[model samples]
Target: MEQNNMQDLLKRYLEGNCTPEERAQVELWYELLDSKKAAANEAELEEDLAEVRTRLAMPFRKKGKLFRYPAVAAAAAVLLIISIGSYFYFNNKPSGVPQKANKLLATDIAPGRNIAILQLGDGTEIALDDQSNGAIAKSGSNTIYKNAKGQLTYVATESKEDETDNPVSNSLRTPRGGQFQLTLPDGSQVWLNAASQLTYKISKTSRERLVELKGEAYFEVAKDANRPFKVLSKGQVVEVLGTHFNVSSYDDDPSVKTTLAEGAVRIVETGGHRNVVLEPGQQATLDSSNRLSVAQVDVSDAIAWKNGKLNFNQSDIYAVARQLSRWYNVDVVFKGRAANVRLSGEVYRNTNASKVLEILAFYNLNCKIETNNGVKRIVIE
Candidate 1:
């Protein structure tokens, strides 16, 4: 069909005046365009669409008036009509309605949210999400507050000698489908990922500011020339005067990855008897064999979760499943050859599980959610 004829057909289809065959053809064109948009990067995709719009505006240019249709509607019609040829040429197999791919799931799972628990030194657990913005607790000279934005902060007050004598530790932990940020007494900031924990002590007299981490967290250390900051995770200790970095030491993950965003850090692996210094934009990975390696990487991708986005760049199916499991609080079971497939893209963390699975299906990977006894499981094939 000519461009002009195809555009007319699409306009009729959009207006619900097309025959069944014409509607199917338009819908198939849209499906192909959506698949291409999903695979293209944001900037490149926008450029390509702009060219399409120019070509689509030619017919209207022949007339003295502008296109009567809205810009969005016009763009959609153009995309549908342009893909008509490719849709028929490449897809010769019997084409039925795409089977609402993600609907096979028994239940839809939601994404992670800002939620965490704070465990005080005295064995008290405070649900940070339940508490309002105010002073929640007091630990010796340190006052703990949950701010309006759901962040936990620690402020120190002058105390008597007796109260200052004993140093108390506090831990901020995020359950599955939850994440939280914290401001330490010394002014350092920490963003904890889902299913992660960070423990630190508040003592003005302490020479060093140290914290232990499990799973993943991004840290922005406060500069203290006299006191170095240290993070302990999976038998590895990262020491710095002041720096921004991310650490991932989840038990299920095979390696401990530390990516430096700014400044410098010295990573020491106690078990491996190895030490390495990482500069800005460098990542150090300590594998199961206790070997440490360094390489340059995109720092934003490493900290995307803390920024409320999921960046999967050449990530294997198992890695993608692990992230989904953490953010959705669901168990994942892989059958067949699901673990070997790799994917790359960025999506909002707040998107629902069904939409996420649907995006995965566009990459030719099969995934479904199953619920049994109130527990949801994602099976990838």
Candidate 2:
């Protein structure tokens, strides 16, 4: 290949877009680069490796290979490719960096500010984070209370309009890595996840109940079959008469997932393009391309965050890093290839940063934990 063609091939190889033959050529090109020279471009080298590894993970149907054990198989394939090139590339470099050390990016979501702003219908904003957790407002004979645990609740108060007491609604949002619980006017319970926002409006006892969510949340909605409950996520809407379920629709996430625990729910995407009727114990995933898929998953695992547990079952390194980022409020940067290390475990939600890092370290993954000026940086191996 000419110089330009070689450069394009290198770029494509690093982006995980190269074919198997192109991959072989990449090894030869890396062999031509002197290690002393390459070491100066260490960061670029790592990026290229990440992209290559990502491409290796793609399924190869032509190979007639079953996709079972995708992560392990992909890791093995990438390792084979790296072995072909590393002989020439690293022999000339210094031995200070361990040959077997895996450099991984420790990408994590920043910690929550333990902050929330309540927007009432009257356009009043209440800074919930700074206030003492207690009864903060009253609506239509219903008392609004915020507990020390950061949960908001509503209780019935005397009403002059009729025998039945009406409920009120308000907006609640938790900043990144923070969580709060809520009891709606209709006696429905909601647990907001980090970086989540929800809006609830008051309703008469006989009217429909509606709310909006951005990010993850667990809902134990009050049962009133006469009045259906609807939750609006970014581009999808979940409508249920009375059900217990969880919905994750973080705009940053690639897909919208809704897991149902009990009762029934109708998940509808915008423009009436996709619709799914989910049953209890069923989870639905809506991708950016508007494809809908349903599968059976353990509801307990899906809603573990609400119970103060970080549960993982056969989860990959990237998935684990995501959970840690949300729970501990740190940033995770992987230094090199993050292998297909499947883990099944649980950690207490309130565990300190070092403890979490120590647990991750046991997985053959190196981690460097540092805190500077209240910001935590977690570097992965």
Weakest lDDT window of 10 consecutive positions for candidate 1: 89-98
Best of the candidates, lDDT: 1
- Candidate 1, residue 335: lDDT: 80
lDDT of 1 by residue, 1-381 (tens): 433355346445433456767756754654556566654434444444554445434543213544333333333444332322234322332231113342544478899888999999899999988998899999878888998775898887666643575678989999999999999988999999999999998887899988999999999999999999999999699999999999999999999999999999999998758899999999999999889999998787899898887767668888888999899999989787654555555556876687567546545566788889888888877
Tell me the deviation in Å of residue 370 in model 1. Answer: 1.5
lDDT of 2 by residue, 304-374 (tens): 78877676656788877877776666677898898677655544466455445544544556777655786
For candidate 1, the TM-score is 0.75
**TM-score of every candidate relative to the true structure:** 0.75, 0.66
Poorly placed runs, candidate 1 (over 4 Å): 1-98, 102-106, 158-163
- The runs of at least 3 residues in candidate 2 whose Cα sits more than 4 Å from the true structure, single-residue gaps closed, are 1-115, 159-169
